[model samples]
Target: MAKIMLVDDAAFMRMMLKKALTESGYTDFVEAQDGAEAVKKYGEENPDLVIMDITMPNMDGLQALKKIRESDPDAKVVMCTAMGQEAMVVEAIKSGAKDFVVKPFNGERIVQTVSSILGK
Candidate 1:
């Protein structure tokens, strides 16, 4: 049971992800609505993994990812992005994200990716 931090501006998206994570046996989750909050929460929560959206109010995911990576080089992050954000996605990877999930999330894929990252 790994703790996860979910960063997204959309409440519904967070809810959907929370449900999927719950169903997959991932119970601990910390929620942040924007990148600045994500960075703050990451420091306080120190979750096992992070699921962050690329587009967000305040700092945005890439910036948050950079901050987190600077704080902890081994931080495991997975971006939640919309379609056609390949450039941003590549930048995220370069900035130290472990992986990413596309928008209009697929429950099965989400579960699988998280599981794979957690080595479950």
Candidate 2:
């Protein structure tokens, strides 16, 4: 199983994502509460992929995404954004986000996206 990192300010959101991924048979996970933590953990954890929220205190996802990509060009990142955040999504893609998932997302969609990106 791939080691996945879930990055979000909300503990509930991280729990939900972990639950969804766990149900799909993904057992390995690393969690970060904000983009800053995410960036720091990325270096330490080197997760196979990162599912990150677009907005967070300390450092936003877009900025963190850039920093991670700057350090590791092959970093695999998928941005999670609330609806009406298409502009940030665009910026994320430009900044090397592998994909974007809208909030209120279903487990299936996220699972599929992760599978596809990880080439599982």
Candidate 3:
């Protein structure tokens, strides 16, 4: 099982992702409400993968992704973006995110992306 981190300001989004991941056989999870918390939890938990939201308070996903990458060059992150954030997604890819998933949440796509990234 992979230890995954789900980072989003919205509790609903986190819950949705968690549910989807759990249903997909990914049970181990660490959740953060925002980028600052995500960064802190990343260090404490060292999860295998991070599913991060692009827009968040106190840092945002891109900045957290950069910080995580700086600390662990091999850190695997998959950015989550709502529709219309193409530019941010591109920037995230440039900054070292392993992949991306768009919202409003497609459970299968999220699982597929995660499985692909983890080579499962």
Provide TM-scores for the models.
0.98, 0.98, 0.97
Candidate 2: residue 60 Cα off by (Å): 0.5
Worst 10 residues of 3 by lDDT: 98-107
Candidates 1 and 2, the one with greater TM-score = 2
- Estimate, for each residue in 11-114, the C-alpha lDDT of model 3 and write its tens digit: 99999999988998999999999888988999999999999999999999999999999989999999999999999999999999999988997999998999
True lDDT of residue 75, candidate 2: 100
lDDT of the structure predicted as candidate 3: 0.94
Q: Report the Cα lDDT for candidate 1.
A: 0.94
Clashing pairs for predicted structure model 2, backbone only: none
User: Where does model 2 exceed 4 Å of error?
Assistant: none
Q: Top model by lDDT, which number? A: 2
- Global lDDT of each candidate: 0.94, 0.95, 0.94
Candidate 1 clashes: the total is 0
Candidate 2 per-residue lDDT, tens place, 4-110, comes to 99999999999999999899999999999988999999999999999999899999999999999998999999999999999999999999999999998899999
Model 1: per-residue lDDT, tens digit, 1-120?
899998999999999999998998889999999999999999999999999999998999999999999999999999999999999999999999999889988998999989999999
